[model samples]
Target: MQIDLAMLFLTELQVGSERLYKIKRKGTSLNLRYEIDGEIHRRSYLSGLSWRAILLFALTEGKAVTVHEMDQPGRYRKLFPNTLLRRLHWYARPNANFPPVARFYDPNGKAVMLLTRSRVCGHAVDALHNLAHSGPVFQPLWISDIMALRPMLGLDLVRDETFSAAMPISAYLEAAAMMGRIVEEPEFPGLSLTGNPRRLVTPPSSKAGRSIFDQASRENPALEKLRDRTIYADYSLTI
Candidate 1:
């Protein structure tokens, strides 16, 4: 289904009261545009990495971001590997289950599971499949779970935030600059909040790219374990 996941439209008086930058999802692709001195520039991305891109962009603008959902469904156990990348959904309320439940999207973009409160609060696992195959039933997980596993997944959780008003021009451009680095990093497969476990071949290191992970490394020691593992015949981590 088509959704307006998030949009950032920056406007400032110094910029002639015009929108300096704008970003949002249409159908499945991301649409980006920016104007400077009345010259508008536009671009689009077909990557499902839309959610993460929006988060980075928002953070760059110093704007708060958040997860939003439209309607409830019959089940929250089935995994929608690509859902989290499509939209930011903090909690899932299955059918009429009074309490809204936390969820986990596939780091490799394969599934989304409804986590039980127990699973949500448990210590993070070593790999995606470890958590996915925890039990017969698919348990949901909280954002904390996702954050804990950020290292294993190659994700940066710093950009996630509650929604805010449109950004100012200066901030929008600064955010755009950060987005450029993320987009240009050859080793990074588009910024995925769930991480990119499928990254079997670690591209040559880029100092700029590694800088992004520096913050994460300082925050958690688990990230220093840069060893790789094979799961279901697929490489789960970059060496």
Candidate 2:
């Protein structure tokens, strides 16, 4: 929820996350934290997808969804080891249960699991893993955003403009295999929603590259309306 000096006093716990943070007010901003390791971790209740909290509200009221990730950790790199650098990953759910059962990767790409069935919503975990792990899924639009990040990470194996949008990862993988290692480390995808997100952009500032999902956020309309809102926190952005 948006807060400002003129807003009335309110207190609440946020939803759609692994942890429930008691929402706190600071000056004109709404912030929350307690027993956390550091001050860098800042979270928004309905932050991930604009309507995520809405969806969660539905789930709490008996709306059934296969996604437990509504509360899954926001950052992917943090969950993996350091050796796993740039990743070109995807999952197809072909069955009515698994809509697109397709397995694919690049010659140089080391397969990584974006969807963790073990973590799928408590009730759906067994069903998701029923097809030998074919229940994992992410949206196609997210793939497009990851493709857009290729240029920034120096994974210029193939220009996105040079390939059909449907098959952009082929170039990304071909490039990574052919020596696309501009970054030795990964950045948190959470920065896209954090107050400090400029590094995720390209040019001389390439160190902040592994943010595979930032590209999709660029086209978000809800974020577009925040032009007049100012972010006051300095977020470190990790799970």
Candidate 3:
């Protein structure tokens, strides 16, 4: 059996270069470890990038790795491709719901699609669970219905004029972190990465409220400026 320390040594050999190596099966499962330097990190293949990349970055650099999961088809194709999957797994199955969707809010608390839905999605929840016990506060924002926002303009979702409803950023992220820690109930027999996968599908807005962006702009001129800058900035310019 390949112990955690041995995996770390193997990963150290592959730093700066990507290589594929098989883990000696321990029992029913294989402990996939990505090691760099003397530090070794282990993750389930099911947990995906957050467990693989984010944790490595955190352990090596002492920085928080920001993870976002998407559920959009258009964006999913652009971000993660089948070629990458082949590199990760001997055989990979694309989830029907690809690009696992996720919503991000600006300072004012409007939801915008950060990731689109696709057939091959990565698991952020499981990654959070592996890293959560280490001390970083996990944050989760429950969007009332992610499907409704699919057609909505990304900009409109971030603003208060169109979508005023939003959860407290800290509260959402922390909850998400906690949710990631939950273990699946064997009796349920379903795929749930974090707390409730359905939370990602819900809508955050109601008929009576304004968009969170508008409210933010009203309260903080700096945020309005940032939004304007983000909206109007040319992509061709190099920072």
Candidate 4:
């Protein structure tokens, strides 16, 4: 039996990160603890960015690693061709169904499409409207659908939203690139980098990258701006 070393590592890492969040959120500066191979490990501190870095590291080092989660048990998720899945997976959580989702099924009657949550983009509404008016039944699961399942899977946090909608594929890629994360080849669109994710965390420098942040910033001016009169990345949780 060939063991999946990467998945094993991620499982432990995820547990530890969650523990770290609980400890720090309480204003306690305690080290995170977890067990692996009968050995205990501890970390003085682990920031959210650091947790994401560890995930990226695992992805890059273990290319064949099947990214698994709680929502879709026993299903290995992929990141490419639509990195937006990562965004919805990592950020979107349970909330009041603002901008309610539209539900539909494929012509075969076997597949169903349920529009759930979306990022800041408004295209999800347009897509749902078009699909409802059009005549193609939904299928078992689209790549985006699979990605949307992230939050529901085994996440310890109480979440109200489920990602039933698909965001623009290009937007994910652009966001990933801006974040300095590796862009998987055209065939697979995911974030995988061998080096530190911090290296790629700089502000968007390209024309297209700048455009994305600019639009997002404008749409969420209140949250994107800082009290010091400076603005941060539109999608950044904190500056």
Candidate 5:
């Protein structure tokens, strides 16, 4: 990969950019982890901007990639020409479910997004949501998924949010790093890349990057802001 392309991918992904919030009521508190996850999933799936970044990187590199719409069609506009992509059947989503994802496969490897529904669209789908994204399993899953691909390019075309959502993650990275697959590119200052099927890490510039200080990502509601001088949006625990 071109150094600039890699650097651009790292920067554009904005690994540590998400500013999360916690809410406190006058007396009771609200549980928004699932809600937060919903919002995150909704954005990740519906937002064309996110997919554009991923596809753009691959197209720029002239790498052949596939995006499984998972039966949802016309959701992601074609970023490149017809010859570049091989799409599966595009299906309709009548109810418009939350956490719908398109599976991505590129020369680097694939990111298998598990949703509530089965591959063939089973009833009462099983969800990969609600499981702690930053918890024990999710972060390591990224490394394992990439490793299994054994990509030809020594990279994994992962989105920036993958790094962010799984923030404060490292043990798996150290393992990948041990293989000399992970390192910082001198060409791009502050770039920390874990290659051999890349292990996504928050670059130094990310606001949510490794830090000792406590960081708050958002503001409390106007009502809550007025009532309690002490109350601020609590950082979400599950998110």
Candidate 6:
């Protein structure tokens, strides 16, 4: 059977909640790890397409389904009925009240997933971070704004991007800038920074790259200020 590779990876996950995964690079290998059923599972990839397919699968399936039980090789197609797929597609459309599934790289150049929620309620970032060894990043401004407006509308929200259009360019810039800063630092202790360092690295000149300097300037105006801080203070160098 022709398998949609994207659907296969995601359905293999142990957990069902919509969460992000981090892909690390070790020399020529891509190291992937995420929490499934509260246990950590790791795999290695040699191709970018393979890694992307894994992530796509996770987002599409949102739960684990064994291959033997599936009719199609692709987990996503097997798990999602036609009706659910249509609903997911409709909700995922640009204007729907769903969080867009976005990919980004950390300073160390690892591939990461950014997920948005439908409701304004608080999410468990620590849980997500623990699953991937990289902490989850929250877009609080967007979440807060959505929470404020949710009471006024009678919409059954599944994600908060419904009002993303109402957000200004500045808001997006600020969110991008914050992500840049967070990706540089090694906040999680379980994950190792040493490896091939290129297999899962971020783009050299993206929003995360720009935030390196911007964050440094704001946190440490003078280079002298960082002297007493932790070695990981400068996110650009460590990640």
Badly placed stretches (over 4 Å) of model 2 are: 1-48, 66-111, 114-239
Which scores higher on lDDT, 2 or 4? 4
Maximum-TM-score candidate: 1
Model 6: residues >4 Å from true position, as ranges?
1-74, 98-130, 137-239
Error of 5 at 78 (Å): 18
lDDT ranking of the models: 4, 6, 3, 1, 5, 2
Cα lDDT tens digits for candidate 6, 1-239 = 01112111112111113221222223343334544335565555443335434433443356442212111133223322344334433432222223333222223333233332221111101001111222332221112111111122211123212222332222322343334423322232333434211212111222322344345346546633332332111112212
Q: Candidates 1 and 6: which is better by TM-score?
A: 1
Better of 4 and 5 by lDDT: 4
Task: Evaluate all candidate structures by whole-model CA lDDT and list the values in order.
Answer: 0.26, 0.21, 0.26, 0.28, 0.23, 0.27
**Stretches of model 4 off by over 4 angstroms after superposition:** 1-45, 63-157, 160-239
- Best lDDT goes to which candidate? 4
For residues 136-222, write the lDDT of model 1, one tens digit per residue.
121122232243233223322222122222322122222223343111123233434232212211122223324544444466555
Better of 1 and 5 by TM-score: 1
| Candidate 2's TM-score | 0.18
Clashes of each: 13, 9, 39, 17, 5, 11
Question: Model 3 over residues 1-239: C-alpha lDDT tens digits?
Answer: 01111122221111012111212122222223434445555543321222333443453354433222333433333333444323323212222222212323334332222322211122211111111122222221112122112222122133122222132222232344444432222312343233223221111222112233445347645544443222002111111
RMSD for each of the candidates: 20.3, 20.8, 21.3, 19.0, 19.6, 20.0
Model 5's number of clashes is: 5
Residue 233 lDDT, candidate 4, scale 0-100 = 22
**Candidate 2: tens digits of C-alpha lDDT, residues 1-239:** 21110010111111112111212222222122211122233333322222323333444455544321212242222222122221111221111121212222222443221221111122111100011122121211121112212222212112112111222222222222233221111222221222221211111111111121133226443433433322111112121
